[model samples]
Target: MPQQNMGDFTLYFLAFDHGQNYQAMSPEERNKERFTREGVLELTHNHGTESDPSFAGYASGNSDPGRGFGHIAITVDNVEESCARFESLGVKFKKRPQDGRMRDIAFILDPDGYWIEIVPNKLKL
Candidate 1:
């Protein structure tokens, strides 16, 4: 698995594409298709070196949004800019930054309908 060093924390992102036609596509095609999907580019971080490349697996099985699991949170450098970029990419939003009382954050849905909360790098009380 590839690793990303973020200050004191090390994070790893393991992505799995379970599209209905995933098994029909070649590895290279799968890689190319992954980037063409909405919200993928924004969610993916730096792929590790060749020795330990980022793992992107494909499966024919479908993925239903998990129950009892809350949304995943991502901290970005700028909330407004990030939201704008996400919107431009046609990512579905559960809650826009200015939609509710909590105007500082936003919620976006992944291809699998999983909610992802976007926050600022620094939280202001």
Candidate 2:
């Protein structure tokens, strides 16, 4: 897609060790296990024409785990339309486009089971 970025990345570590200890540890503990000076990095992308650029939301982390991290989101022009189009193409949705506690949103899972939140461009939190 013309608006898609091919160089975004999200990072995650295995918070569980088999079935022995399957609990989310504190940030400190998690970092100590494999912490870098930069624990987390959030990236912002601008969309729309240069005259009226809109926030496209955060990009994925530099890396992510199979079943650990939550998701990254993108603001679309229309949630319902986007969901319908993607669904027609066989995209798996973790959540359908509908009302949420804070806003209207939907979730689609990637092949790796990572959720990609889709929200309207005018959505408010």
Q: TM-score of every model? A: 0.47, 0.42
lDDT of 2 by residue, 1-125 (tens): 01224344334442223343323655455445443332233332433423455644333442554444567777788888999899899999878856456447898987656678887888443
Error of 1 at 38 (Å): 26
lDDT of each: 0.66, 0.58
Could you tell me how far off, in angstroms, the CA of residue 55 lies in candidate 2 after the best superposition?
36
Cα RMSD of all models vs. native, in order, equals 15.6, 16.4
For candidate 2, which ten residues in a row score worst on lDDT? 1-10
At residue 122, give the lDDT of candidate 2: 81
Tens digit of lDDT per residue, candidate 1, span 8-114?
Answer: 44554344344436557776676576656643423333335333556553221225344345567887888899999998999999899999899989999887677
Candidate with top TM-score is 1
Give model 1's clash tally.
0
Model 1 CA lDDT for position 69: 54
* Candidate 2: segments with Cα more than 4 A from true spot: 1-68, 99-103, 123-125
